[model samples]
Target: MNTITRLFDFPYHQLEKYNLSDSLVTKYGNDWIKTSTEEYLDKANAISRSLVRLGVNKDDKIALISSSNRTEWHICDIGILQTGAQNVPIYPTITSEDYEYILNHSESIYCFISDSEVFEKINAIRKNVPTLKEIYSFNEVEGCKNWKELLTLGEDKDNQNIVEERKNSIATTDLATIIYTSGTTGRPKGVMLTHQNIVSDVLMSAVRVPLRAGDTRALSFLPICHIFERMLIYLYQYYGISIYFAESIEKISDNLKEVHPHVMSVVPRLLEKVYDKIYAKGDALTGIKKKLFFWALALGMDYKPYGENGAWYEFKLKIARKLIFSKWQEGLGGELELLVCGSAALQTRLSKVFCAANIPVMEGYGLTETSPVISVNDMRNGGFRVGSVGKVIDGVKVKIAEDGEILCQGPNVMIGYYKDETQTNDVIKDGYFHTGDIGEIDQDGFLKITDRKKEMFKTSGGKYIAPQVLENTFKQSRFIDQIMVIGDGEKMPAAFIQPNFDFLKEWGSRKKIAIGSTNKEIVSNEKVISRIQEEVDASNANFGNWEKIKRFELTPDIWSIEAGHLTPTMKLKRKIIKEIYKDLYHKIYS
Candidate 1:
């Protein structure tokens, strides 16, 4: 068995061990295409040979931008790395201006895009990038160079030796890829990660995921440009789990049913949406069905693992699982044994309820610089904890700083920020990477993240409030879809919220209340405001008086990545959201 030290080595090792027939699957039109391990390696090698013919050199940077996850991206990732070149994966939803900044900063020489949507963004700024020699499209677009041309060029088999030679010369510690963090504010920084960084993280994170050898399936819809999903892609390959790319974000439910994946990775926001959608269905039920639904939901909310709530409660939960929670499992593909949430803090209620429903959600924590998994909730052993991010994985050491920041030291940490020593030094000190998140490890070794050190703000009274904690607490309201706490230098804390419009409309209809139809009209409804206030008042009991939201205003729009209210990873772009809703911010503060 070959020791897997590099990013490309994962699939090759899978071929030796599992020889999976469906190594990677992507939907084309209405058909799902499967690529075997042998085929995946062959195509990846072809990509390498093709790049060699195109004058690509070791350490040369190439940029890949995709509007959605696809099989080509993984092939290109391996193909690019095998040639000793690093690929830069950028967010497809970012502005052309951001596209120009990252391409220029990384000095990417060749660019590959998934479709015309991503192509248009890049092609608009293609002239501004002096180092970008040519553009290739994975999906054929009008008057664009296609990636197949490279494969065709390499088909002659003449430069195959050169590709192998390049592979042999590449060390395990060599640069693998440059990922531009879709930052909440400022220009994005290219986080340079070595082959070992991701490979080690994948190996360490694998022990946490319970799966059968090469027999299970994974549905990947989260942006592959993000390290969380990308690293999981490699991990899926390492586990011999067949990888299926959801057609689009809109089609995840349909794809989930079609593939019936055994495992999936989701962000906290998506899980919240799933829970909300499920709750809305239950809300529509009549009579005894409705009564039983709320009964199960109540029991789920108060759930604890390892029968900590005792035998009678556990027996009631088993009845709840059969009566109601089973449908929740069925909705997410009947065999969904696990879902790992990350990129933001998950509500403890969401984790507890979901786990109680028997669909285990292991909320993990890490950043792109750490090759992403610093610590994650595990299902094996007694590692299942409801509130924490679970125990730190083996080989990764986490210690809480005096300021309550999590500082990590491990092989998985990135080499540094690409070409920015000062920024790198700011985060990395004394051989430990400063995580920027305030967290504490429990006596039982589970790690719980409290809040972002930088995101915590102070009031005029000198009281500090952790907005994430407050937001997560309030989001348990089900009425609030999105909330941002704002009170810096103010007399008291307040918030700007995006109400769950779906629930609002249904609730309005159910009560025969005229809350109106449009987002603007609904938010302006006095009754709607009063209803949400009750929820806020209910949630405020969990917080200190200073930490509670004194007042809040509803936003007339949804907070989304495409709307500039959120980063691609679904974290709130607070500064951008503030600017977008300046009028709403003023209304709450005034």
Candidate 2:
């Protein structure tokens, strides 16, 4: 059980012993900000000294509210850790009330905000949080202290010894971070994680998928507040890979081309969007090019990764690769070797299409409480099973409970939920953390998640339906952008559908159907409904009569994080969706 103390100590030692400097580059606007390893270490040490001068001590909690992924974010995080204080990350998208709750609960003394907007969020609730002493803004603010002031405060050379002593005094078991889960069910609970929990995951995951220094470049777009990306930042530094942060969510595609990164981690929603864009482009092609594009796509979707296809299928695949798939790779900046997808189950059809096009998508599964890397597909050895989240990482053990819930045991598991022993006990029992995800391990050691235990519901006929499974199946249709199956306490299943507007527009022109501009009119149109019914019927053909969706309601409104229908990671907030569409659900049942 090695700890992150050694991991944290490496940068300084690299500066002193190996003369390693200016290796990390972060993107700011159109310019790249390059910081030497030594420079970063010095700045972090200075910030640490400043915090001590501000009366911050070991075990104190410091909160950060930021949407940007500048080098300063990493420096502040390491600086807080160097002082043996815990870092509490707050999502910038969260409401002011959530900020108050987390800051008050953690008793954070100092808060760092990325911009004025974030500062305003904290400022609104600053009076409510009695423990908060100061708010530092990374960007210039009229009333708030800028983050650079800390460096000026720490200029005294005498504080160097104090910084070193504090770093050495911190133990691996000491709390390093307290990440609050973005609750779908209730109030957000802070999951306490030690250096041991996170470092073990980084080390084990590195062993599973070896990322080399000087060879791997990563473009980061996922929020640093997320454990998935936070852990990845450490892994990138450990492997000596240069990381380029995208300016914003909208700039990811442009950044990917400019960075030409070797590897990237993304949520499935982004991947889905990429596929949708590609499909839209394919649909826009004409004549021979259009026919060939679709033919290649069909062949790609039927591709078998393990070479299980017949000679005829293999022959067509080679032609598809040459004629169409190579363009897909080129479109993704021509250097992407591995695309790591998580945060939700990727549609298996989409997975096959990408892999078939030589763009390997490695889907993994984990939770924030596990320091996020539980299992990931092995890209090097071809250990990928299309629908399965690859083998559990080294040093982690997983088992299926009698009720089919996935239970995990590893050093990577969190210590407990902060100040909630009862809630912690409910999940962790006899050293195994109950994941609350229903899954089973195959003979090949791949784990396939069936559904969320809480999400699976039984109909009035006693037949259980996994909404995710049904939704995923329906989403394979080109016309469907999103689908949510509903059948709780009902005789059969129904769905709320969001049509793919691009596909529908093209379809409408081809069929001479007048699609209304408004969502209500579009959904109520007989022609649109009939087309959606066709797709639903095709999807239902694969399921039993009890499992099939008998009716559906279409919506024109897109689900988005800003709209409160989706989480930051783009996962549907099911309870919120159910509540918002209660009338629609009743209409389907009626």
Candidate 3:
């Protein structure tokens, strides 16, 4: 087979070549379930054959709705692909409206769900979807067909020939998946990616971040439905690496300790939480221990990735590594060699600190339209940049537009937004996909993101303010949890702040301050407001007077996915936040 064809069909080839036993590990309740490569392939093949029997044709769309990461997710994904069908993955946390929109838009024929809860979710709106033919559940349900029954449907000898013919018929340019982008603005767009788009990315990324089969153990916690984690799964399979699915978001710490994985993928939000937990522990320490903890953290924060510090600084860092950061390593399973952070910009301070503590955080940049990875930090390639998203990967060409928007041209770019020619034309023009993000390419070829072109807003004084810049800066403060900087057509930049409640309560206790019973009372307290003001002032010191936040309102409520304030990826939904806090915004400016 040609290189492109081989790349497109590598997953199935790997399954056929690898041994049958003990290849994949999945977490089930308190136990780990091990499945051999052959076993996995058999199940996936059976599902593919069954799908064919159900009249699923090439280019047919299949929707999968699941919450937890399990072996069945991978099995069904591969199965769908084997039948030359496209997979439409939906986040389990998405709204019912989203479910209806995606199912109808994609014109999915078969729906596979994880459990009864997900089944019920689909069942509620099943009548609305005209194209959907059958519903299958990974777990046994009252009304849905069990996934295991698909194997029986494919038990006939003729099914094997059908499977081989289906696999052979698939071309590298054929549409592999129709991933709906969870856009922050307007309706979600379905990004259509071909086999070549994803396969090229998988291969290119593998070169940057090398992994060995049987040697590297990966702990998967990020949503598999998301392209970032989904792409990593294919990369892991390509190298024959063993993957352990994390039980849930809450169990990540415990799972890390148990798995002792060499590498893992994460979003910036998770890293922020981890840092908070670490700082909390340090704050809990007393006397000399507390002093040392703060000292080490300060040293970490000031660390530079590329430049050299003096011998004295290096000596102290060694001591900190041995004394303070060693325990941090242990808490993370003690074997974490690399952490691939994407989905959002990681704070430069956090990245530096973690690296100084001997944990390398490799930050990358991409959107759903680019088959996800356009650039990433490669430790072996001198591509590590502290504040920048590393050098653009091989086979991808990145250039800055006159307005500073990053434009990319590569094989990895999606064909088009599914059935939306106008939208497709808006982004992909002259073979370059406009990334909407304003960024600059440094002398070293590293990409430094400044702000989003669409997100920058001007105040009444005509001074433009980038809310993300201020929000990122303010979040560095231990007192702040989540913040949104708002000032479009206003006098000065103002903010709606969510204080780190746990940290605030601890501070209140230490100071013997009386925090009232209600959330509103606590947030509106003079002491609480004063403390948050100090934090805002500290963050504002780095900016100009016009850019500084003049006034702010404290919100006791946390922004979350269910509450519609955050996207599934944990990015703040600015429009939603504005609408929800319309009165609060007026109050801040008033």
- Using lDDT as the measure, which candidate wins? 1
Compose the digit string of candidate 2's lDDT tens values, residues 1-590.
12245336545544544333444677765688888777888888889999988889999999988886777888899889999999999888987888899999999999999998898888999999999999998889989999999988987768778888988898878899999986544778999999989988888887766566645678887889999988888877776677777788888777878888888888888888888899889988999999999999998878777677988888888899899998888888788888888899998988899988888888999999999888999766767888999999989999999999999999999999999998899999999999989999998899999999988999999999998888888887888988888889999889888888778878888888898767677878889899889999999999998999999998778877877788888888888888888899889988
Per-residue lDDT of candidate 1, residues 1-590 (tens digit) = 66988888898889999998899999999899999999998988989998998899999999998988999999999999999999999888888999999999989999989988888888888899999988999998997899999888878888889988998898989999999884434878889999999999999998887867789999999999999999999998888999999988898999999999989999999998899889989987999999999999999999998889999999999999999999999899899988989999998889989999999898899999999999988777898788899899999999999999999999999999988888889999999999899999889999999999989989999998899988888888778899999999999999998999988887888799999979999999999999999999998988888888898989888888888998888898888888998897787777
Writing each residue's lDDT as its tens digit, candidate 3 over 256-315 gives 999999889988889999999999999899999999999999999889755478888889
Residue pairs clashing in model 2 are: 22-36
TM-score for each model: 0.98, 0.95, 0.97
Residue 70, candidate 1: Cα error in Å is 0.7
Show the lowest summed lDDT stretch of 10 residues, model 1: 181-190
CA lDDT, every prediction?
0.91, 0.85, 0.86
* Candidate 2, residue 325: how far the Cα is off, in Å: 1.9
List, in order, the clash count of every candidate structure.
Answer: 0, 1, 0
Candidate 1 clashing pairs, residues 3+ apart or interchain: none
Question: Candidate 2: worst 10 consecutive residues by lDDT?
Answer: 1-10
How many backbone clashes are present in model 2?
1
Candidate no. 1 TM-score: 0.98
